[model samples]
Target: MDKIHLKGCRFYGYHGAFVEEQTLGQIFVIDCTLLVDLEKAAQSDDLVDTVHYGLVFETIKKQVEQHKYKLIERLAGAICQDIFQEFPAVQAITIKISKQNPPINGHYDAVGIELERQRP
Candidate 1:
């Protein structure tokens, strides 16, 4: 499958289990892989034939900024669902989200979750 890959898409969101993490907010980096068949777009070179990545980016941004979740897992799921709903051409999607400088014990740069889903 052909896909549009977006990496290091960052957003500040108040999403976490802890009070400090939610109230203070933090940077979240997201990597999205949107799967689709791009043959028509590749051949026709028409914007209508393919999904606009700008729209996708905006969609993600809206979701991340507007909603609060206790877990990145839930956030990932919500993102996946939104993408699939808005872009039916997508056959599958992978969403990876990370919190920078998490509050876990010891020294850790970040903590994250990667989830993939496919249309039935």
Candidate 2:
């Protein structure tokens, strides 16, 4: 299938296992790979033939900024579910969520999780 890559989506959210994290919040970077068929869009050359990436970004932004969860996993799941519901042409999605500064005692880059899901 074809792909639509939405990368480097950053948002400020209160999602973490620690109370301070939920209180102070932090930055979360998300990348999404949407598996879709581009044949219709290629032929029609119309916005309606494909998913509106702007709207999709807004959907993701809403999920990230408006809600609070204890885990990024749950946030990822919510994003996938909303995307699937909002965009019928999307067949599958691969999402990566990274926390900029996690409450860990070590020197390293961002840490997070990636999840891939298909329409149910």
Using TM-score as the measure, the top candidate is 2
Best by lDDT, which number? 2
RMSD (CA, Å), each prediction? 0.9, 0.5
Query: Model 1: how far is 89 from its true place, Å?
Result: 0.8
lDDT of 2 by residue, 15-86 (tens): 999999999999999999999999999999999999889999999999999999999999999999999999
lDDT of 1 at 82: 89
Error of 1 at 47 (Å): 0.9
**Model 1 lowest lDDT segment of ten:** 100-109
lDDT (C-alpha, whole model) for all candidates: 0.91, 0.97
Quick one: RMSD of model 2? 0.5
Question: How accurate locally is residue 55 in candidate 1, as Cα lDDT from 0 to 100?
Answer: 88
- Per-residue lDDT tens digits for candidate 1, residues 1-120, read 899998999999999999888899999999999899999999999998998888899989988999999998999999888898898898999999998766777877788999999986
Report the error of model 1 at residue 8, Å: 0.4
